[model samples]
Target: MLASRNRDTNSLLKSEKKSLLRFLALYTSLVILLITLLSIFYYQSQEKLMFSNQRAELSKYAYIQTKRLKVLHYFFPERTTYPRDPRFKSAIYDIEYKKIFSLLENENIHFNEEIYRAGNYIHFVKLLDTYYLGTKYLIIEVPEDMAWKKEAWKQIAIGSVLAFILFMVFGLILARLFLKPMRDSIVLLDRFIKDTTHELNTPLSAILTNIEMMDTDVMAEKNKKKLNRINIAAKTVSQLYKDLTYLTLKQEQKDHKEEIELQGLIRDRIEYFTALANTKQLYFELDTENVIIHADKQKITRVIDNLLSNAIKYNKRGGTISIKLRIGSLEVSDTGVGIDEEKIPFIFDRYMRFNQSEGGFGVGLSIVKKILDEYHIKIEVYSTINKGTKMVLTW
Candidate 1:
């Protein structure tokens, strides 16, 4: 029964995993989008502020140049033709030559001109100061007239990359953190299933054995028949209990890949269940090959027992239970009430009952499946209702 639950749990987990991953991907994408938008906004704001400051400084310089021209045009009349102070010593279109001569002439005035030149610089002007007492013309340079906005672009690139990296780091860590509790819950559930199955084995065995020891013959004939059917019911529970234990602990038994005679194994298990078959008046049909299987003996025994007992329980009165152990296959064919086509695959699932009168927990074939899986074996079942059923196990 837990085996079926495990399969169902696995399916649920698989579905949940897909949803979690899709959600994580979507959240990560959203983080990236928000970060990109913020980076763009930050860079735009900084660009606007930087350009605004540049424009303010340029406007102040233009106003100073216009005022200086007005002063020079009014106060200096002999210099209306542009006075040549000894301070203005270079030829008319040479600011470099003028500054060089002025520096050699007077260190104090040259220092003041150099300070102003460093701030609102006009490179190709003719005078010591573009704001000098001039002949009524002014020269102005704006930082915006440059060919490239290199610094603004550099800041934008750096900010965008940093935002992208920051979001990636946070997204990965958050996704893992969010999924941790779910992973732990799944692990706890698996352990609980395994533990519960283990606890059931001892009591179920005692119940089956005590029922077998009951004195049914001394009772009314009808009561005797009812007791016998109860015994069958008990055995079916015992079968399911055994299968659950097998699926849980059978793996660590170190009982894989053994060379054993197939005929002897079949005979041994048949003899063990001979009493049960006798109660149901089912005849045994055995076909042997002296073959050897490299597999666990106990697990194979469980598979045989489940199949044989099922055939006996579901068979008609005095039905034939045929078992064949061939070279590459082991087949069990029963002259019992067969199965519907739709129920064949479902039989391997837990607690799936097609016939309520079968008196089983419906875990036998699931155990058969588990054992066969360990040995890399495959099984096929074909049946028609009330006719017969044949099961083939291929290795």
Candidate 2:
């Protein structure tokens, strides 16, 4: 049951994380897009203002030149004199929009009132109201002011980078705010499980101890059978209670490590499960060497108990369970209903049960895996449906 709870919590955490990431990604994208659009608008507005200022200056220059031409045209018609402005190049066009005279020869200039950029110059065209020497359009071309444009671009780049950094920080803050409730709920659930497991430990231990103390020799045959069933049921609950206690409170327990004889430990655990095995007429074949391991005795016992319990619980009637313990490895193989190929990968995952028909909380392998991992032991499992399963542990 604790394993099932853990699995549910893990699944919920994964779902919450995925949702948070998706929301953050979308929020960040929209924020970045808005910043980009604003940057573009600001840049274009600055460029337009610069261009407007350039056009105003060019208009004033053109007006001065036009005034000079008008004076020369009305007073001194045969002089062929033109206004000279050394700041920019000037051109004159007739009413037909054909260039009549220019400071620069063979230059292609568009005759329009709007300011335009061509090559390395800002071109401005204006139509004069009063004709001077048959001139109708006064066109002026000035060298572009690149320094101001470079500064504007630099500002835009800096602004964009700063905006991106600010939005990222805001997005992270928003994500944490959104996930706070889920985090609180998970914390509450963990606290509840810890408290509940703490409450169950005493009663479960009392029940198992009382059952173990009961004498079967003085009871009737019928009563003996009933006692055996009760014993079996109590042991099953005890195992589950142990798994939960280990998961919730094992860290609080004192560590006591010692050299344990593998053969002797296996024999003891198998003896404890013999009565349960006999209910299904299951037999055990032990082929073990006298190997000793240095580890916590209780933890190693839990590992062996879970493996032996699972083998008996899932074994077929009159089936055989083979146990092998060598120098660096221990293997438990059984001729019980085996797991499917697809379920093999997740066999050790919390709450994962292949044989639903069997009576168990499905936490046995999960506990086994945890204990093995703590001891730096590697476990390998091979199973085929309706055939058998072999669990091998290598230290």
Worst 10 residues of 2 by lDDT: 6-15
lDDT of 2 at 238: 74
- Candidate lDDT scores, in order, read 0.65, 0.82
The top-ranked prediction according to lDDT is 2
lDDT of prediction 2: 0.82
True lDDT of residue 65, candidate 2 = 84
Displacement of residue 312 (Cα, Å) in model 1 is 1.5
Candidate 1, residues 138-215: lDDT per residue as tens digits?
233432333224665676678778877787777767766887676666556546656767777787778778876887
TM values, all candidates: 0.46, 0.56
Clash counts per candidate, in order, are: 0, 0
Position 69, candidate 2: lDDT: 84
